[model samples]
Target: MLPDFRVRQRDYLLEIARLLTEELDLEKLLARILKIAIEMLAGQAGLIALKETEGWRVATAHNIPPAFLSYLTPLLAEEKVADLDVTELNRMLKELTYTASMGLLNGTGIALAAHGQVIGVIFIFRNYADLFSANDKALLGSFAGQAAVAVHNARLYGQVNIEKQRLDALLDSAADGILILNADLTIERVNDAFERIFGRTHDQLAGTPHAEVIRWARDPIGVPLEEAITDGWPLTPNATLY
Candidate 1:
């Protein structure tokens, strides 16, 4: 029975890890994580507090009261993983005049870190009588690490896409012709201007050797080597561009 339980538990943990690492959208991933924590770990309430300039903000939450989250901000200033006992929970909630709904305040939290830098924290509050077990604490610890890495990767991918779009737009609007060559002398890129000036499509010029794509013959009027090359240049043998 223990072996079977272990196998099933490992499978579920892998699924959660996959979701945390594979989902590239930050908000969507956070929503999924909170939902999974509530369901899988039997958490009645959950929230992910991401560290920001002003302070920790509730980036995402499920069944978590705004007031309760506001109260946790100061404690979250110190990053660490901890399984909250009733003693500590009561101490933190002493001023709130705890309500019946707040009975499920026993749970665990972990600091979200990426590449050794703390980025955020995640919490899943469970029933006071049924506090988080050792297994639950370990699982949530693994989740925190995976979620942080996903956030970092998603941010990087978004920035790269934005920069690529910006560069493409700039190149398309440029007046001067531009051709970028690879280290092997093959054409890496040709801007819209280059395509128009050479009277060739981008697809036709790309990946072609510079020597084969450009006519390197002597000038008919004895113009200098560099001056001899002009806009109406014809392509060499085996060249697709005219």
Candidate 2:
């Protein structure tokens, strides 16, 4: 039978795995991951620092003093996770942790990596004298692996959302009528110009087939617009009455 702590660790890891797929907001995801990591390791405080173009910045922290966090941020910002000197870094971190709170005596850090790239680092601080055990490190490693993937996914999701917003803004601002279609050529979206020109709202025309909406003039191209588009028609722009 598994030890109670091992069982709890398993449960925590499973919960993190679920969050990986379901949680896409990077801030919220990092907060949850940091909280879970601290709880799992029984640490007094913990933080996840994300690498940015400028430098490493604290993405989230649990039970950490604001003063300590302010100091820690610039300290980490001096170097990338890969370029960090572990021994020297740990020494400095321990010193700072001690200064932040005399009770915090032990600290450990692990790099969070995904797809062979180091994205961030996780640091957990404890009040006890006993250093983190080898098993504890191993468990934290496994948890960090999943957490890294979640963080990477959330970043990608954020980028995609930003691009989507940009596209929506462009579509809405267009002077020419624009109709976005799905694989089946159903109306996914119609821009404001299209709605104004056709006297139909997107809400009324969405998911409607293009054939049903537009009355083409007696098969000008001798093929349906869907078939024409599918067959790579309009080699050059040609005016067609509709």
**Which prediction has the highest lDDT against the true structure?**
2
The whole-model lDDT of each prediction reads 0.67, 0.83
TM-score between model 2 and native: 0.86
Q: Over 4 Å off in model 2, which ranges?
A: 78-92, 218-224, 229-242
Cα RMSD of all models vs. native, in order, equals 8.9, 3.6
Per-prediction tally of clashes: 0, 0
Per-residue lDDT tens digits for candidate 1, residues 1-242, read 56643654576567666975578777887788777666657777777767665555668888766676666656645443133333344344432324535543565677778998766667677756676777776766666677678777776777898998998889889998887777566888889998999999889988998877777576444443233334222343443332
For this target, which candidate reaches the highest TM-score against the unseen true structure? 2
The clash number for model 1 is: 0
Model 1: pairs clashing at backbone N, Cα or C within 3 Å: none
Measured by C-alpha RMSD in angstroms, how accurate is candidate 2?
Answer: 3.6
Candidate 2, residues 1-242, lDDT tens digits: the string is 99876897799899999998899999999999988888888898888877777766788898887877777777677755425544455566677777767654678888788999878888898888888988888889889999999999999999999999999999999999998888788999999999999999999999999879888666555566666666665563672332
Lowest lDDT 10-residue stretch of candidate 2: 233-242
TM-scores vs. true structure, each candidate: 0.61, 0.86
